[model samples]
Target: MNAHPLAPIPDADVDAFWRDGVICLRGLFDADWIEHMRAAVEDDLAHPGPLAREYATQAGQRFLGDIGAWAVKPGLRKYVEESPAAEIAARMLRSRKVNFLYDQLFVKEPGTAAVTPWHQDGPYWPVQGDQILSIWLALDDVTVQSSGVEYIKGSHRWGREFRPIHFGGDTEAYKMLPGETLPDIDAIRREPGSGGLEIVNWDMKAGDCLLHHSMTVHGAPGNASSTQRRRAYATRWTGDDVVYAPRNGQASITIDKPTIQPGEPIDCAVFPRLWPRPQDSSLA
Candidate 1:
């Protein structure tokens, strides 16, 4: 955590994260870091990795998404290794050590009308635990109207799982198996605070980020803004409690080789540990 460019999270911010399952740390990353990441995102979009999922011309929106950019982009790898992001995860999770999960890059071009369905991230992931969290950094200034993600506060405590929604609006997955669909988005908007549900959102500038719990119910509106493009990178992290629980029939970008059991601790060349100050702790 060498002179972590990010500011140390205050007690209030930590409290907000734990209580609300989301917290925004303003300017935690410097302009240089943001620029580096933005460049990486632009370049990656231009070249495009095998994992990149882009909308076709007929989709009527320009939404491009990719996972696991660290393996393909050097700038992303540098930010993951050097930035204060891991330390932030450690302090929030209250864990002695942390692991880099993976990278998610989502870009919403102007006038994009695709809505990211409201859902919890846990049901879709192979890893399972309460200590999962993601740091979403803004590459450009964004507002709630401009496609910033919104979270239903305290939803992480609901302790229920829902079917994962594919990016292209296929509702078949949720229809196949049943848990509970995200508490009706339209109803919540109509009757706010009716059932302990308070929707929280933020207007963010470049270098600002929202750290959200993995289980938090979140989604975003279409990029309604006519001019501004919404580019965000979400880097996930895991703590001591996280484990490999690969769900049958789901492929994870984080997992590549070897056979780690369902309940084994996650560590290796993949999911690299990032906390307790690796070199300094090794010396200690």
Candidate 2:
């Protein structure tokens, strides 16, 4: 698989990410990468790692999720260190450098009815910065009916943080962050102007990816399709300004705690530096 984007990312796309807190870049990963990721996804499903979790929504459909794949999966480790993802993240966030935070695999099987709750990623994590973002890559053809994610345009600039809603009715899962949580976005969508907000989403092919800021408020629907599965791999990247800020009752997947102190750049053995490729060739 190629280590760089197949085509150059236009300046306009970068601008849109800053303006809207999210943007979909088409065909950045080639077919080879998709094929490789598909195999990796299947392997992960068969042999899940430490952080894997299985969820069954009210409709009794299955939703599978796992995080920190690069720690155990060879294919994902190669993708994290060698792929163009890090550079793309750096360019989009306009950061001088980037680091690999973690990888998550989300699989909503055909007919799954679990609605990923509306929340901001920043509050759930143990990090702080404007440059943190996630690249969600589709491994299968995705449509609105097949669980495409929807983002509130420019919510990241609202200068507000929302408490995370634990998936599958586990309110006690995350320690609530200070401030009011998100309003009913689904309810708001039914009204005109969607409460003066523009929610955005896209139909994506296997190689397409959506990059969104960590503070962006977003959520996904269940896989309404009866045939196609909605499988996506998300990689979270941190830019130059981000720092390690551990929180109590962090909701994100567990990792061996880093030696890096609080308020310092998260460049420990777990969250390795990626953009300025390390001198150690084995890691790069």
Candidate 3:
């Protein structure tokens, strides 16, 4: 499989990423990668990793989540290192280099009614930087009825990190960084004269993906479709500005503590450098 994007990322898409804090790039990944992820997702469902979770849901519904699969799953590791994802992230972030931070899986079985609450991805990690983001690759066709994620357009420029939302887990390890409390988004929408807070989502195909800022407030409804499954593979990537800064109450996703010191570039064994290939000494 070619490890490069089938088409060059257009300048408009890059502008959208910076202006709106999110962009849905279509047909970026070839069919080969999508099938590989589908197989990996099935295997992960059967034998979940340490951080795998079965979130609370109503009867006949299932919401499964897992993180840091790249550390143990060869398929995911290959995708991170060999796919055009790193290049895409670097271009979107406008950074000269990039690093593979981690990967997460969100599987909402048909009829699942577990809603992902509104929250930002920035505060959930033990790092800090404006260049951090995630590429959410759909493993199956996705629609609003099938739990397609919705993003608060331009929320990343809000310049504030809301408290992380806890979804029925051991909250002991999940602590909040210094930030504003999460606003009642639903209530705000119900009231009049509310600031025009727009939410955006799209119908996505198996090979399409959404690139979103780390601070973009986003969430998704349950898999309301009775027969369609909603499975997505979200890979987090960091650019040159990101650094390791372990914090208390962070998401329990880092399988092992990074060997790098606080305030150091996240370029240790856990988060390896991806861009500027060693062979391409010219770029380096």
For all predicted structures, in order, the TM-scores are 0.91, 0.96, 0.94
Predictions in order: lDDT? 0.80, 0.87, 0.86
Best by lDDT: 2
Q: What is the lDDT of residue 6 in candidate 3?
A: 86
lDDT tens digits, residue span 117-177, model 3: 8889988887889999999999999999999998999999998878787765444535545
RMSD of 2: 1.5
Residue 161 deviation, candidate 1, in Å?
1.1
Report the candidate with higher lDDT, 1 versus 2. 2
Per-residue accuracy of model 2 over 1-284 as CA lDDT, tens digit each = 77788889999999999999999998778788889989989999899988888876555688888888679899888788887899889889899989888888999999888888888988878889999999999999999899999999999999998887777778777654564768999999989877888999999999899999999999999889999999999999999899999887776554566789899999888888888776777545
Between candidates 2 and 3, the TM-score winner: 2
Give the Cα-based TM-score of candidate 1 against the true structure: 0.91
Q: Give candidates' CA RMSD values in order.
A: 2.7, 1.5, 2.4
Best candidate, TM-score:
2
> Which stretches in model 2 have alpha-carbon errors above 4 Å?
58-60, 279-284
As for candidate 2, its clashing pairs are: none
Worst 10 residues of 3 by lDDT: 168-177
Model 1 lDDT per residue over 1-284, tens place: 23373566788888889899998888677777887888888898798766777753445678888888787688888888888788888888878889887888899998998887788887777787889999998999999888999998998998788777777765563455446756677575776555566888998888888899998999998899999999998899999999987765454675255356779878866778877666665322
Better of 1 and 2 by TM-score: 2
Q: What is the lDDT of residue 80 in candidate 1?
A: 83
Ranking by lDDT: 2, 3, 1
